[model samples]
Target chain A: MNRYSLNQATTKYWSLEDVVAASAKADLSWIGLWREPVQEYGVERSTKLVTDAGLRVSSLCRSGFFTSTDAAERQAKIEDNRRAIDEAAALGTDVLILVSGGLPSGSRDLDGARAMVRDGIAELAPYAQEAGVRLAIEPLHPMFCSDRCVVSSLGGALDLAEQFPVEQVGVVVDAYHLWWDADVYRQIERAGARICSYQVSDWVVPLPADTLLGRGMMGDGSIELRRLREACDAAGYDGPVEVEIFNQDLWNAPGQEVFDLALARYGEHVA
Target chain B: MNRYSLNQATTKYWSLEDVVAASAKADLSWIGLWREPVQEYGVERSTKLVTDAGLRVSSLCRSGFFTSTDAAERQAKIEDNRRAIDEAAALGTDVLILVSGGLPSGSRDLDGARAMVRDGIAELAPYAQEAGVRLAIEPLHPMFCSDRCVVSSLGGALDLAEQFPVEQVGVVVDAYHLWWDADVYRQIERAGARICSYQVSDWVVPLPADTLLGRGMMGDGSIELRRLREACDAAGYDGPVEVEIFNQDLWNAPGQEVFDLALARYGEHVA
Candidate 1:
């Protein structure tokens, strides 16, 4: 339970105050937060809510769609990322997740998009480090590579992260996004503490119409979650194991119920 | 035009005779065939139909759903694969594509699934080699990893392929399945002549209600088709550039028209 965390996305309808209260009441040591909700609730107020409730934020959901080809659009995204860094700092979390957006609209330049990711990280690394936050590059599944995030493998994320200081940047080993890779175990080992977070979600097939909300709760699908958690532990990551599902069904359930179910499943399948 | 191969699935409703006649009319040098349809039409009859029209079978669509954990089921798949190799030999195509089946139903043993693929390939290689057929393992997109093919990247397919004699086993580099991979070009380079066929398809987004049929015509999506085709050529794969797509919309279109469109797109995006 000490290392169990509920990423607010699993209970998407819940407010920041509600998530913090639920996590603290459930005796969970950590809660992962999204920037929008935190900002909407007022970062300072949200920060105080979690801190007062004796809960720590595991990571800030994200901010990094740097694949834009247009110079002005790219600069705007980077600017927003700067604000994300400040928000992460306010939330008292060292980790801020980054989802590198897909190929620019109508563009076939995948390599150029990946280069933008690398350049974006280089531009933001010092800023993140100065703010005492580590930007965690989250490699989404290859299915989402065309539109959501270009970094589709942990090894690919590490390729970019390795170019920065470990404290400044790292990779998030989210089992749902990465469990399919044959080289994932080796990449997780290589990630070490460069593994900023270990998020758990199962890959249930017949993905919903909105594939974004298709993530299943732990233990409900095909992932070998405990094995992944074990791999992370072996790689010297003893931090909180965040349960971050995005299923619409989970979102509709009561936040506390979702949190409780996630914790129980985490115990059964990932602890 | 000499290298253009019309993969039959792009015109799913077309008969083997129609595909052959269309390819002949289009002046395409090759036509890729599916095992079931060819078998239904009689392999010898289909072979003669294609050869009579001056269209060579670029490759046989597939075999090898050997991920079953059950012994009897596994053995059955291998025997079926043996027959597929014989059929490929009869049709006079050296490449018999393999889609390593997904994880066994309700089984979370992905590594075990991959092991089954490797072992199954090992078991069938001798027969394929005897038939003068090179088993080309096609790594489907990672989206299909759980229920379609365990092998999800060109590198992963090559890992299994390199374990066997290159002439007996090889990998298929399909643009739709592999374009998002950062290491695809490097893997293509490593694949060298082990690349048995260069399959092309475009990756369009907001995948249809049935994601399997979401592939777009080459010029309609984001994959860098010409770049990938060139990668294969650079890797010494000067084989037919097989234009294989699984779009439901394309399937419903007139076969000859689809063939013409595929040829045009092949020239514009893949040649």
Candidate 2:
């Protein structure tokens, strides 16, 4: 119970205040937040809301699009990430999830885009380290490789993370993104202490036309959620298990209903 | 031109006779065949038609749904695969592509499902070897991992292929399925002589309602088709480069138009 956290995205319609209050009411010790909601609520006010609710921020949703081909756009993104780092620090969360951007528009240079990601991280790691925030790379599923994140596997994410100090950069193990991988268990073991966050969501198929909103709730789909949670535990990660589903159906449901259902499913399938 | 083959699926609306005739008319030396159409045209007649057209069958499209949970069904699938091997031999193509089935219904044991695939192949490999047919594992993109092929990467395919004799088992390198993999180049190099088929299709996104039909024509999407073809060549794969797109738009277009365009694109981007 102490380790379970509700990522606000799971209940996308819920206000920051409402989610924080609901988490506090449910006696959850942690909550995961997104950059937009936190900024909308005013970062300091958002921090106070969580703090008053006695909830710690497990992680920030994301900050990374370092695959731009344009120099100015790339530099602007880097600066934006620095602000994200400061936000994570201000919220008192050590982990800021980084979704390495996809291929540059009209370019087929995957290797070059990946190199730019590495360079982006190298530049930001120092700043993140000083701010006491870890830039946790979240390897999205390969389905999103061309348009979303080029870092499409846990091993690939670890390869990028291992290039820097362990404290400065880490990886997130999101079951929704990685449950299909044959090498997932081995990579989880390899992640060790570098796994800063472990997010849970089932992967339902016949994915809607918008593949981004296709994630299922825990236990509702085919993923071995408990097995993955055990693997993360074996990897020396004792952090919050954040429930971060992004389903249109779940988002359309009442926020409280979705929140309560996520808690129940997590307890049954992921605890 | 001698190395270019047109997989019949790219022209799904075309009768097998039409595709083969078009391939022959275009001076193509090879044609890739699917089971249902060949079974429809009569395997003996289909073989003679290709032979009469002076076209050699590059490979047989499929046969391996070895992941059924039912004992009777599993046995039935193994027997069907034997027929498929005999069919491949009858068609005079040494390569029989295998799409390992998805997880059992209501099951989340991915490792167990993969093991079933291995066991199925093991039971059938000897028969395939006797028939002079090499079982080619086609690792689908991870998006299809749940409802389609459980074998989801070239590395995973190689891991299974290496367990058998090189002559008995090989892997298919389909650009649309494998281009997103970070370790693809290394895996291709490692595949070496274990490569039975190299299928080409670009991966266009905003994937349609039916994701299966989302493959784009060569040079129409994000894949580095020429780079991948070069890598396969470097790895000693001098076999037919089969153009195997599955886009709904292409299927609706005139077969001759699509066939000519595939040939032109192969020369421009994949050859």
Candidate 3:
């Protein structure tokens, strides 16, 4: 079955209550909740709303900005991730998506920053394993390599994942990020069953901004979503095709309208 | 010895005559000649002017954009690059830099575009080798992944190089493009003597524009030039440090003044 999951950020204009009601109204069987929304409604209430609506938590929004040189900061990040994992487990999310952060302050040594990320993940893997939530390391686009994430390739994420047990460490192949990678298909195959989630969003060829908020809607941009879906399906990833858009324009629209657009686009282009 | 080369675009306000005079006055050992300047001066006069000024050609400014999917278009690019190689040879350049082109039209398949680039390089390799010029693949910043070179990493370039004999393929580690790569040091080690040219420029964290024209001058931005030079030196790469800035503001300034600033920054920050 081709299931469509609405990542809450697409309609960030809505409150947690608003999103839950809208998700129920839209008849979306799956939804990805963010940290702020979960915190706002309290995890128990958020979990209850999902249960009541009969909606599955596709995955938690994120958990891993693990790129720090300081020991205390790194430990704090790991602890924060542990909380995120606990929340994912509570929400019955199968995966806790991780976005490895960028270079530490004043540190131009990229290799050193990457080692810190690996160590930070290694430190947190046991707790994630014990919590029953798969840690999905999402490789952000190379544009975010400096400020947002150092892990900018599926190959790099897989290299990091190889350090941990397969059940605990997996990768989220977000099309918007991995679409520009030359080895996407090969890496997707390499990821195989370890791909915890497959995400879809188009790469707006001419990015309007350099920050995180300029992502395009699934079909509005230039990415060949059908080909990406074919690759993911071929790789045995029979998961929800999560619609994750970080566009400011989409976020400003009404929740139901955004949800409807995503659903329509999914059916028309992605499915 | 630390050798300095002025990339003509850095002092774009100057004509070819002014650039040659400025280099002579600056006591700079070399200058990277661009196509526009060459065409303006006629290749014969351009080569003679540099020779008269006792300046060497470190490299020809560029020659690749090989992302066109059509065989004829791709072949035209190769032919253009061959002409560039001849230009480089006439000027006694050690390398003809190749800026591998962006995503082909109507295509989101980055791997396929990269394969086209590899084939383009393979076809151009013999022409370059026969002319006694090395083809240096300059991996652009990831921001350029879509509309520019899909080769966004030193590792990616090295991986491509492994497809051919080592002597024919090499990489240009431009600090602006590769300052944020996690595997830079390891890739540098892997590149070893294949590191044909080292270009320096700073990465302004929040890029002012999506285009390639806003590049920051060496000490004005975040890149650690001395440290990168140390890494290159440690990896047994003793090459001339070419200053390549693409700033509009700097380009508007007097050419001699820009050269003075670049030379001062090069000595203070890079030497």
Q: TM-score of every model?
A: 0.99, 0.99, 0.90
How close is each model in CA RMSD to the real structure? 1.0, 0.7, 2.8
RMSD of 2: 0.7
Weakest ten-residue segment in model 3 chain B by summed lDDT: B205-214
Ranking by TM-score: 2, 1, 3
lDDT of 1 by residue, B1-23 (tens): 89989888888998888888888
**TM-scores for chain A, candidates in order?**
0.98, 0.99, 0.96
Pairs that collide in candidate 3 are B102-B148
Candidate 3, lDDT over the whole model = 0.83
What would the per-residue lDDT of candidate 2 be over residues A1-271, giving only the tens digit for each residue? 9999999998889899889999999999999999999999999999999999999999998899999899999999999999999999999999999999999999899999999999999999999999999999999999899998999999999999999999999999999899988899999999999999999999888899899999998887889999999999998999999999899988999999998999999999999
**Pairs of colliding residues, candidate 2:** none
Residue A78 displacement in candidate 3 (angstroms): 3.9
Give the clashing pairs for model 1. Answer: none
> For residues A1-271, could you state the per-residue lDDT of candidate 3 as single tens digits?
2377888888888887777777777787888889877988899889999889978899998889988778889889999998999999999987999998987876666677778878878888888888888899998876677677888788889989988889989999888887765567888888888898888888775666546776887777667788888898899888887888888888887777887888888888788
Candidate 2's clash total is 0
- DockQ value for model 2: 0.86
The DockQ values of the predictions, listed in order, are 0.78, 0.86, 0.45
State the lDDT of candidate 2 residue by residue for B80-129, as single tens digits: 99999999999999999999999899889999999999999999999999
Q: Model 3 segments beyond 4 Å from truth?
A: A68-76, A233-236, B69-72, B163-167, B219-236, B252-257
